[model samples]
Target: MNNLGRNLALWVSIIVMLLLLVDVFQPGNTQHAAQQLAYSDFITDVDTGRVRSVVMQNQNVSGTLTDGTAFETFAPQDPSLVSRLTGKGVEVVAKPLDQEGSPLLRYFLNALPIILMVGIWLFMMRQMQGGGGRGAMGFGKSRAKMLTEKQGRVTFEDVAGIDEAKGELQEIVDFLKDPQKFTRLGGKIPKGVLLVGPPGTGKTLLARAIAGEANVPFFTISGSDFVEMFVGVGASRVRDMFEQGKKAAPCIIFIDEIDAVGRHRGAGLGGGNDEREQTLNQMLVEMDGFESNEGVILIAATNRPDVLDPALLRPGRFDRQVVVSNPDVGGREKILRVHMRKVPLASDVDPRIIARGTPGFSGADLANLVNEAALAAARLGKRTVSMREFEDAKDKVLMGAERRSLVMNEEEKKRTAYHEAGHAITAVLVPESEPIHKATIIPRGRALGMVMRLPEGDRLSMSKKNCIAHLVVAMGGRVAEEVVYGKDNICNGAMGDIQMATRVARSMVTEWGMSDKVGMIAYANDDQGGGGMFFGGAAKNFSEHTAMEIDSEIKRLIDEAYDQARNYLHDHVDELHRLAEALLEYETLSGEDIRQIMRGQPIERVEVDETTPVNRRSSVPQVSGPEIVQPGDKPENDKDEGGEVHPVPQPG
Candidate 1:
């Protein structure tokens, strides 16, 4: 029934019940207010012929007095009593005890409780089944959403970046719309296409766009929907999903995060006899069984293609593997512009500069960057998102939120300035290192100082020279600490720097084959293992002595990089001191400022009083003359008293 009719029926039934209660009980408000009389007086009145009329039912009696007032009292349920009332010259009558409503209400009230209970039971059943009458069964039904024509609003124009992957899928979209174009030529279209990429690279968005372009029914589901706790439920779901797709005929079934169920069986628990495996087996059967699934294009996305079952990737199944990698610089610019279209951005906010600054950002990351910039602008009570806010947002995304509330002592601040100055100076001196983008002494995230380097362009691969130069620049912080504060007074500011340098050294020795002892061979677990990507796969194939040689080689590389850093800093001590002083005075410096300083003047090797600058510059730097060490030579007067240029302990 409609809601209003149902409600009206309910209220009418309730009113009928209330009326029945009133008719049966006959509340005192509807009875006459009469003078009190004893049973003997009632009998006297009845016998004296003073009563006009009387009625009796069971043990109750009702009569009207001579004055036309009605009265009621208890009496025996007897026919004799009524006869006596009739013979006393009084009119007698029966009460007929029926209520004043229609008889249908009686029947409806009796059946109303049953109807309400049945309706509630049905509602609970439908809820447990899933929803509506269609889900009246258990969880065997497919959960794939079937979007009809014009349902999905996302088109190809909405997605930017990952053009190669888009190009690969465009043909799939075309085939979905006109399948006979390829079928008449005996060319079988691929039933399944796998989109492989990292998270947030628009894999799912691209799938939706394809659905929009095809103008057909779109079925979207995740792989987890196929797997259930029950043994056969998953397999039944898979069959049902395929059945749905087939009924929809010209439809696109996009399975997101297919890896959840597509993992390699027998690799983990249950020994390939789990519900997921059964689901996968049923999926394989329905996908490429005896009958060909025509016009039901299946597309799935995953980040980890390594663990997928081989059967899922075979020729007739997932024939095409389109990789949706992070976009390059140009693609990033396009994505930024696409996201910025909705927000009011200032003219100074150039997508090119933002893209250049963000080299490794995916499409989602760029979108988030734009959102963060807008949020920053809004937080500052600004209407337009400016480049300054974008830059700050990028810094926040990369380094972390600014720790403006953190307080630092003067000594700590001075140490942070020198540490940052060392990084900037090394970056400027080292030829292979990328240019220093910005240097700051203000605390951000967990670091006390920061030196951000922006590469001229994205580097797909790093050279060994560049790697070593990075190491040298990384050690510059500790190198300066040792140069100014002496080895005993160096703090733990270079803990992160040391860790990065060690990792590079290890990678060079184990994976990159840069170690002299390792030759042109990779000893990494990735190169040797049949093991999983996450779980440490295999032990390196080498003797204990060879392992010792590898460790020694790593230490030696670090030592050499550190020596190079120390030599560079020793020669440019005057520049290092000036830069540190400038940093102390400004508390920050931009890339342009560093470049200007580098181009402005060469620092003369002249001594200054420790108390002269008031910026707390270290007093250890002294140059005898203008002569300094070249690339292959070492300084003469910087060695220790032992006359041995031994390896020094880096900070932390």
Candidate 2:
């Protein structure tokens, strides 16, 4: 198009130049030349009648002679006179002399160039506005990219970690490939399939694979592309998109993030006149208007299918909604392997280990893992990616890279080490708690230290006791600091821990029905309504007396758990100090190192003096009675009597 415009401008300029040259060189008047030569000879032959007659003959031939004028009937006798008369009698009309052409014709000719230029300008503008041929100016054409079999090379094998979703979509591919096989048995292919899951689960990749497998045209676009600033542009775009799909029959239209446009109508504050509602209405109409067995299929993907309108998920529209969730260990392994193929890996690098390390990674996460590993190896100037590099890469992906530049003073470092060691020791001591896999005092991301624990397995159900045990483990760090380093060392490190513990405790007391005072009274809403309030009620179902009792019970549970952690650490102070020192040296400690320390030394049993009063000897009541005698199985506190001691349960 640019070249065409340039060529047209050049041709117009050339035509104007040619017209100027013609006007400059061409003769304006030839008749005036003859009259000048004739007058010169006529003066020499003034007395000769022969000359007069010659002049008359010349005038008659030139149509300038009067009927009464004497003229030569035959040829002139005098040669010079004859020549002069022949030229004189022919009168040349006075020629209008001007260098330039006529004003009207000149203006028309000059303006012709400007007119032609303007015409070409308008043509270019029209081409640009109309998509060069596709449609009108500013028309909302769907920006969906079409991929044909020739350009699409992805297959089912190319995508990983979404097998179930792929399996559901595979039927669509089969229909496209062999429609007759199903049609002969009176089986009708579904009009649409909705890939529903969180982001980065390979929903779009599966769509491409289908396109490649079926060797058909694939039109891919986002749900937002259907919306426009104009009120009806979205609906117009939807109509145009379906029309194009119909032209390319046996094709797939993949709409990514369909919830953007398919959000439930009349749910928001905006009423029926909403622009998005109009677009969604048009989409629903188009979906229902299409025949089921027309060979054209619609495949849409959304992370938030919950927000989409129910009409879009009806039988005639999207009948099947496949969930593309985070991959399991096996799926992770496959996804890792698929990504690993692209990187130069060491012989010792095992993707299974990487897969096991990342439990909740999706296909996109695995791909990023591979890219990060490559980058790590590149930074190290290594030829092949090793297991250590992959591990570093995984850590970098999960939490950010270790910030060596995040400087800390000796006091801060020691505090962080003790805090992390406390969490690890508590996790190891508590039977219901998950095992601590790694504990590090190194500053990574915003955390001064972190203790990573591994669950026994993926848990879909959790008990009240389990929740309380987890909270105890979370609170152990601050509790340990208070018992050993005194309350002064406890900083903002426990904010997140306290928040998580409080939430768990609330869940146990109100929702899980674990509290004795508020048993089975679920104050939490099932839906966890979108608003900030957890539940709509201003007060609990129980009376004020019961509420006080519930509050007291909750505080007692938390205090008991904190005191238990403190006692455990106080008994093993030497080991705790040793672990903290080791952590300071290495910046990290494994679970095995922690277990070895606990096994090497035993805690000394504290003996009470008979001289001390029974009531003053213990703070916690024994047997839930007035007596203050220490429980038989309770670990004695080595600290002051002001310190609490958890009543250790008796073994069966």
Candidate 3:
């Protein structure tokens, strides 16, 4: 029954029961106003002819007196009592004495509490079981959901940017389609396939594509689904899930984020989790144990394959491990095409150009880029998404949304303008440094102004010259401020630059072995074990004296870069002033504009909106610019720091 019906029935039954209980306890009319009399007094009244009428039912006797009074009494078991009442001309009535009461009613009243208790217990059990026969108290049942053909069907065609991983899984699809072909050659399909990669790389999507191509049943679940607070529940669930897979042979069972339960056994703090370990053990047995699961394929995905137990990744279990890395330039272009199919694009929108602009982006990130562009176009009441919108969206994703409402005084604005101009000029002059793409004093995210520099193409590794050039470019902003506003007048806008420079210098000294004094020795700590402060961190790999050398080398690198940057700015002081003035006038300058200003030519500015500054002849014409660096009130030394304008951190 529905909940409302069940509740109504229960309330009705309870009301009946309460009434029955009240009736059984108080067996007479509560509203009666009758006085009690002694047996002798009742006899005297009947004998004196004062009794008007009498009614008797077993031991209870009630009657009215002749003087207009009402009374009730119990008489002794005497035969003459009735005869005396008749001789005195008194009316007498007798009712059948239900001696043992109703046997059925009495039985019902006696067993009501036990009956209600049993009914409530059964109801609770049904609720805990999720009102399904397969749900055994809801804890031991498999939470894996069966994905049917009609429900959000995804095929290999829908997946892109991970062709190698897709090709590896295609064999599984073939095996499921025609198992006899593989069997004829005495080939056994992989029992389990583990997809290892960073998040948003489309591991789970690949699994769904496998199911779609094979046209087989897909049962999807999560690793955490197998675990619960209660001990042994996870194991039972594992067993049940495999049993379900067995019932639907030639099916794909996807467990996303398997590392949750498949982490190395007994390697955590306070011993370990008994429930999770037990669950993992049961899963291992089900995968490649004595009972062969021939037609069922297990697919699991996790970013942290390092922490997974060795047993889980052995030859028998997870026979194939596919690495789904970030898409390269070609793959990214293909991925952009896949996501672009759903959006309305203008004539100017070029997927290839957009792909080239976004480096280190995953499939999910590309999808979000397209969505953000569509949203921006829609917000502007445009019919289709344009290249300009795509560029704006990319900027928003990389840097952050613009904070145009922010207010800054003239002094701070001029300081920010010079600081960013310093970064742009240095980057342009340095041979190995990347070309300056844009420079701006407009606020974005947390920065007050920034100068953005984009590489000519994708760079896999950096040379020693390139590294030193980066350090010089990092210190340019601080040097510019110092030269323009005196030694003590420089603000704290270079903190981010300093931090970035220091990290690069330390890595060069300790990790990359670029320091001559360190002599090509590796002293960096390995974080693959996932150890940190809570895990007591890793021990120092190098001795105390070696560590001192490393710190001294890092400081030396920074000092040299700062001096070099200061010299460059001092020599080209006129170009720096011109760029800073152009930024202050236009509020933003593209690469072409910066070049025009450097050559003593006026830039043709086209204002598209309140916040966007467009250069018609620019090579890159989007609203994309540099990171915003806030000029802090604090004073610092003649060194650089950092801000959001450096390298963008790719979101997973």
What TM-score would candidate 2 get against the native?
Answer: 0.71
Candidate 3 similarity to native, TM-score: 0.78
Model 2 clashing residue pairs (backbone): 53-71, 53-72
C-alpha-based local distance difference test score of model 2:
0.66
Q: Whose lDDT is greatest here?
A: 3
lDDT of 2 at 249: 86
Q: Is candidate 2 or candidate 3 better by lDDT?
A: 3
| lDDT for each residue of candidate 3 in 35-100, tens digit (9 for 90 to 100) | 798989999988888999988887778899998687889876887888888999999999977667
- Each prediction's whole-model lDDT (CA): 0.73, 0.66, 0.79
* Tens digit of per-residue lDDT, candidate 2, span 594-635: 666567643222222322222212332211112111111112
> For each predicted model, how many residue pairs clash, with residues at least 3 apart or on different chains?
0, 2, 15
Task: State TM-scores per candidate.
Answer: 0.74, 0.71, 0.78
> Stretches of candidate 3 above 4 Å error?
1-136, 268-272, 526-538, 606-644, 648-652
